[model samples]
Target: MKVDLFTLVLIVFALGVCVTLVDVGTLFSTAEATVTDETEITSARE
Candidate 1:
């Protein structure tokens, strides 16, 4: 069996998109946690 160029390109593009989405999701969760922690620390000081 032989694979064509278009099929390869499509597969690579799909994988890249999946990876990007996962990274963005992880970053957003991390930022949210950091904000919550900071708020707790500031309130505790008062």
Candidate 2:
């Protein structure tokens, strides 16, 4: 029973990590898009 509980804890931890990684990736992607848009606008003005 102890072993089963330990395994459950590990699985939950792993899932939390996976969700955090995905959120980080999404944030980075949004930042990149915003930068690209700003660059395009600046170039157009010039």
Candidate 3:
């Protein structure tokens, strides 16, 4: 199993997009949030 630099960068970028989506999802979510999730949203805003 081998990966080139371009492929690694793509993978990292994709993961970051996924993380950003999750953060936004949590922000718009109406359900109860844990302290950790709240802190994550707060930090993401700053």
* TM-score of each model, in listed order: 0.90, 0.83, 0.58
Q: What's the C-alpha lDDT at position 9 in model 2?
A: 95
Give the Cα error of residue 43 in candidate 1, in Å.
1.0
lDDT value, residue 46 of candidate 3: 100
Model 1: per-residue lDDT, tens digit, 1-46?
8889999999999999999999999999999999999999999999
Alpha carbon lDDT of each predicted model: 0.99, 0.97, 0.87
TM-score winner between candidates 1 and 3: 1
Kindly list the per-residue Cα lDDT of model 2 for residues 1-46, writing each as its tens digit. 3579889999999999999999999999999999999999999999
Model number with the top lDDT = 1
lDDT by residue (1-46, candidate 3, tens digit) is 8899999999999999999999988876644467668889999999
Candidate 1, residue 37: lDDT: 100
Model 3, position 9: C-alpha lDDT score: 100
How do all the candidates rank in terms of lDDT, highest first? 1, 2, 3
TM-score rank order:
1, 2, 3
